[model samples]
Target: MGIVINQSIKNTIITYIGFAIGALNTLFMYVQFLGDTYYGLVGYILSAANIMMPLMAFGVHNTLVKFYNEFETEKQKSQFLTFILFLPFILIIPFSLIGYFGYHQIASLLSKKNFIVYDYVWQIPVIALCMGYFEIFYAWVKVHLQSVFGNFIKEVFLRILITISLLAVYYNFITPIQFVFALMGIYLTMTIIMKLYALRVKMPSFQLVIPKNVKAIIWYCIFIILSGSVANLLLEIDKFMLNFYIKIENIAYYSVAIFIATVIAVPSRAMHQITYPITAKLMSENKHDDLNNLYKKTSITLQIIGGLIFIGIILNIHELYKIMPADYSEGIFVVFVIGLSKYFDLILGNNNAIIFNSKYFSAVLILGLLLIGVTISLNIVFIPKFGIKGAAFATLISITLYSLSKLLFVVFKMKLYPFTIATLKSFALLIVTFVLFYFWDFGFNPVLNIVLKSILITAFYLGLSYYLKLSSDINYIINSVFKKIRN
Candidate 1:
């Protein structure tokens, strides 16, 4: 818990800073500087790349985390690390060849509905390659329990660069087209930096020495690819599908809503950076009791924090939208729908870490494959009728169902549930605060209204959470802060 709390706090702060920069880009600079069409194009390109990222990396990122601790000796560990580093090239080479040979056909298919997407279609694979390797390197560091630097690079560095590039656009230093290319360059640069940092943490042996469990490792990586693809598809497929179903600019609209809803998941994302590797280590050591304790603690802590974010977003969303371009306001419903789904996900805490690191990971692969099918089918059916709102509905429904399935699997297979009496209490507190705050708003400027409401909501939520002792870890941290203040 010490290591988890220490790094998670740092990761959470870094992630928030990243999201703040992203908010500026998504809500203001993107709309104001790039305009909606190019914004949508950029959004589509990135989303499509994310969907392809798992396949491109061939699941090496997750494989590294799950298997890194199995070896006891430095020689074995270095062999494993060396293997993980190069394993992706097996898929990368063939994928690159396919992309090279099928460029026009691939471009044509993606841009059929919106032709602007065709020219930038090449960037999808390029960015996906960068993203795939970035995660692999990120996992390289995470397994060593050194996640802060990697988390900062993952969360903050790229967004800051994007801020600079957006400013570059604003100052007429770069065209919108150049901005698109600059994004690809940014991802590449991030990956290179991550690789260097990963090596500093533990350099992989250049000589290829296969571990005894190479067969099992390869099998795990294969299953991980399916699971990773399913997860990424669930998150990014909506934007990809929307490109075909709606006008390109509408992707920008949906992206704004998605971004707003996504802020709720930042705590989960930040905490997972540390919890994931720790969960893997616990499983490797067969420490079921510690693992379960961690499960409950992380679940409650993320729920409390994520609930506050959910409430703030839903409550202040309209006021926030008031300051944005009128066209972007239609995504308010998208915000609520996706925000609720993400909140549900957050409460599950380290459920993903538990399942992915467990032996029954193969079982989840079947469920994940089914989930991807359901997600895509729903998108095809819904996006045409309701547009971006339909995309939101599809995502909300898909994530809710998928989350329930994973929860049930864990409960049945591992006898571990993330919920407790505190969970219910925390959930009730969230509802009460939302209901109480929902109808009220200051007549001040939208930004001022948002800031005021957020402060009040934070005070109300955290005060109640502390009083109820919903999470001992959270309460302890609050008391520590109070003690420091008194001293």
Candidate 2:
């Protein structure tokens, strides 16, 4: 648990740093330099690539992580790595070709405005392939218990590159189209770097051994593909649907709010990165008690951290939006809606990982697919009437239901419920923080008020946490930092 907390702290810092850069770029630079249309295009391209990523990688990223521990020998591990690396190429080439030949048709289907959509079509496959391979290589490293570096690369490196690209556009060094191309190139470069780094640690030899359990590996990979695609769809289908049903420019507005809201999930991502392989190992050894404790601690800790972020965003969203362009202010409701959904996710903690690694993973995927259908249906019905806000509502409902379904499955089937007294206490703290911060008025200057109120609100939250002893992990971290400073 200490190690998980330590890694999560490191990853959380890196993620926030990257997020700060992203906030600058998305709120100020991109919105100011690139018009809404171009900004939306960037959002669409990335979302589309993410939606396509699972298929592009053919689920090898997750499969590698799950199967890595099963192999006993270094040679066997190397062969497994080699298999995952080469396996994606089989899908990549054909997928790229399909994307190439079907590019215009896909573009036409996506948008009615047809404003330079084809210009960036070529980048989609490239971005998808890069994202796919990056996940694969990152997983390869994660299996070796080397996650912080990958976290840095994922949470910091890519955003830093995007920040640079946005700066180039702001300086008029590159046109919006060129910036899109540059973004594609940056993803490819990052993938190559991840691959090289993984190789440096353990050169993935191309030797294929006739494993007795190769059939099981293949089956696992197939399951991963289905499960991964359904999961990605749950996360990303809304943006893709927006591109279809609404104006492409609206994506930028929605994306800005979604980014702010998604920050609440950062701690969960960090914890999951370190805890997932651990969960797999525990499950494999039938260590149910250890797994249950991990699940409980992860849930409570993430809820604590994610609750703080959600409160920060919700309480200060008005001031935060003051920095953005005027048109984006309408996204305030989206932020709240999506923030709640992400909060639900955080409350569930490592439930998804537990389900994915469990024997009932296929049922989980089937349920996920059902939720995807509900999400799309809700979007279809609500988006026409409510626009971006409607999309946010649909997301909130879908994800809340998704979280509940996973929790129920884990409890009913696996008898794992990650709830404790701390969970209730954290929820109480969240409500109190929101109430205290919500009605307080600090003055006319949104920025100044936000800054002052945020400081006050954060201090109050921490003070309350100390009074209640809400989080030993957080207390330990603070005490450790103080001890180091005193020394």
Expressed as tens digits, the lDDT of each residue in 84-115 for candidate 2 is 77887767888777877888887676656545
Mind giving the per-residue lDDT tens digits that candidate 1 earns over 1-487? Answer: 9888889888999999889888998889999999999999999999999988988898989998888777888888888888877888888889889989999999999889998888898899899999999999998889889988987888789999998999999999999999999999999999999999999998866768887898998998898888888898899999999988889999999999999999999999999998998999899899999999999999999999999999988899889998888998889999999998999999999999999998898898888888889999999999999999999999999999989999999999999878899999998998899889988889998899999999999999999999999998889889989999999
lDDT of 2 at 206: 77
In angstroms, the error of model 1 at 106 is 1.1
Model 1: CA > 4 A from native: none
lDDT of 1: 0.91
TM-scores for all candidates: the values are 0.99, 0.97
Candidates' C-alpha lDDT: 0.91, 0.85
Best-matching candidate per lDDT: 1
